[model samples]
Structure formats: structure tokens, C-alpha cells
Target: MAKNPDIKAIITTDKDLVINSGVPVFLSKNLEHLQVLCESLERILDASSHEINDETVIIVAR
Candidate 1:
């Protein structure tokens, strides 16, 4: 993904989750639905107490 001046970085995952840093961004181009995708991930994360990745932060851009 191309870098943006306002964003520090853009990350693409195998599951089609695009995460952006510095500025929050979620680019779910291939996901079935944005809400479903986020809810699914949220369930997975809620199952755990500890942080999965210190560097990874989930943010919703409205």
C-alpha cells in the first residue's frame, strides 16, 4: 500500500484487514461486510484479556 503524509504506515493482512497507523484507517475492500468483519474480530479479541499485539491498535474512522 502507498504511504500517506498524514499516516505513518499501512498494513495489509491475509484476512483482508487493512490497518493504518498514526491516523486511524480501516480499508476492508474484500470483506463481506465492514460491521460483520469488525464484530468478528472483536469477539476474538474479547476472548483474551492480555494485549495481542502492542503495536496494533484498532480504530474506527467515522
Candidate 2:
């Protein structure tokens, strides 16, 4: 059986902009760090990463 894709976590440089939620949020030092974190977590979390904007990325399980 297949499972529905669901948002697993969110990564952002500006933690203040993202609201508190059930999803885990990771705050990075800057854009570079955010990208790196997103890539690493995408693999570690076994999920795909998506760019919400310049400063935000979200991870979703496939």
C-alpha cells in the first residue's frame, strides 16, 4: 500500500517568520547553512526537500 505524502519538517533562516506547529523546525545560521541542512536532512530523514522561498525550505515524506 502507498502512503500519502506528508510534511515532515521545515527549515528556515528566520525562525521568527515561521509559526509554531506540529512540524519540527530547524533554524540555520544563514542561507548557505539552510541549504546544507536541508540537503542533509532530506537524506537523513528519507524525505524530499522543497524551497518555499529564498529563506525557507520544507521537507516532505514521499
Candidate 3:
């Protein structure tokens, strides 16, 4: 038996939290990007309106 097992722990103090796992990231530095994302998100939400009935969290990046 191994004395110690390999494990990973994540800790953060950032108000904006994100987790990275080789996934692509979209970063916003200005209102333009935010606006574009909002519009796109609205379209997606509208398309999937029936699937969402509660407050949701949409994380964009880490």
C-alpha cells in the first residue's frame, strides 16, 4: 500500500473563479466583447428556453 496518494487540490481567493482543463477560454477586456457574448448567450438561451427554468451560472474563463 502507498503511504501517500497522489491528489490535486485547488484553492483560490479570486472573486472571479475558473477552472482550466485544456478547454478553450474566452476573455473579455472591454464592453464590446461582453456585448457580443451577451448577444450570443441570449440567442442560445432563447433557443434553449425550455431547458432553463432556474437561475444559472455561466462561466466563461478561468
Which candidate should be chosen as best, given TM-score against the real structure?
2
Clashing pairs in 3: none
lDDT of each: 0.37, 0.90, 0.35
Off by over 4 Å in 2: 1-5
lDDT (Cα, tens digit) per residue for candidate 3, span 1-62:
74542212212223254457343233444445544554565464342111111222232321
Candidate 3, superposed: residue stretches over 4 Å from native: 1-27, 47-62
Candidate ordering by TM-score (highest first): 2, 3, 1
> Tens digits of per-residue lDDT for model 2 on 1-62?
97866999999999696777889899999999998999999999899998998999999997
Where model 1 places Cα greater than 4 Å from the true spot, the runs are 1-26, 30-32, 47-62
Per-residue lDDT of model 1, residues 1-62, tens digit only: 97522322222223344433344344544434444445655564342122224323343222
Per-residue error (Å), model 3, residue 29: 2.4
Ranking of all predicted structures according to lDDT, beginning with the best and ending with the worst: 2, 1, 3
Better of 2 and 3 by TM-score: 2
